[model samples]
Target: MLCAICRRDARGFGFAPHLIRVAAPTVKLCSMRCMDIAARLKGMINPNKHEAAALDAASQAGGVYVELLSRTDLTTWSEQEWGRLVDVIVTEYQDTLRRAYADDPPI
Candidate 1:
């Protein structure tokens, strides 16, 4: 295995399995140092707990859309179904924005 961060021979590859099997399935690093560096490189090279939780929550909230879109004939949805899905998504989005700007002056 090669270090994903440095492309060097991955000395850290051995520990990768027990460390974070899910997140870095294919990523192999020469050492723990490279993994640490990856988390610092930003762009969620390794998302923190808060970031991961937020993402998970967002996905959960979008479950309706994902479920519907996964169908081969999503266009067959009834008007009410589409309306309900869009309404849920819009409400979730608005709530997120509301939380984001909670400390700012009211609109």
Candidate 2:
């Protein structure tokens, strides 16, 4: 499928969650870059140096993204950029839901 970001023949097999451009379509995409942020805010009030510390590295990078959001005034940005942002957000969200219910029976 085409990448929402580059519109190229993306490594992402289809129009899926910000399916990051990987080396190949056969490769699975990661939930880490996106979920690391959620995991941190969900409970980790502070950066943990414990077993979950590995997530801290990714979470910290996610934190930088958060900072970037607040640091910039989105209104001043162009519509194209905002639209692209929405595309990625929506894709990621759908992918999250799919994973969360993957093992559950459908009603």
- The best candidate by lDDT is 1
In model 2, the number of clashes is 0
TM-score leader: 1
Off by over 4 Å in 1: 1-60, 68-72, 103-107
lDDT of 2 by residue, 56-97 (tens): 433554445546666457777677756655555444444444
- How many steric clashes between backbone atoms does each model show? 2, 0
lDDT over C-alpha atoms for residue 99 of model 2: 46
TM-score of each: 0.35, 0.32
Clashes in model 2: which pairs?
A: none
Model 2 superposed RMSD (Cα): 15.1
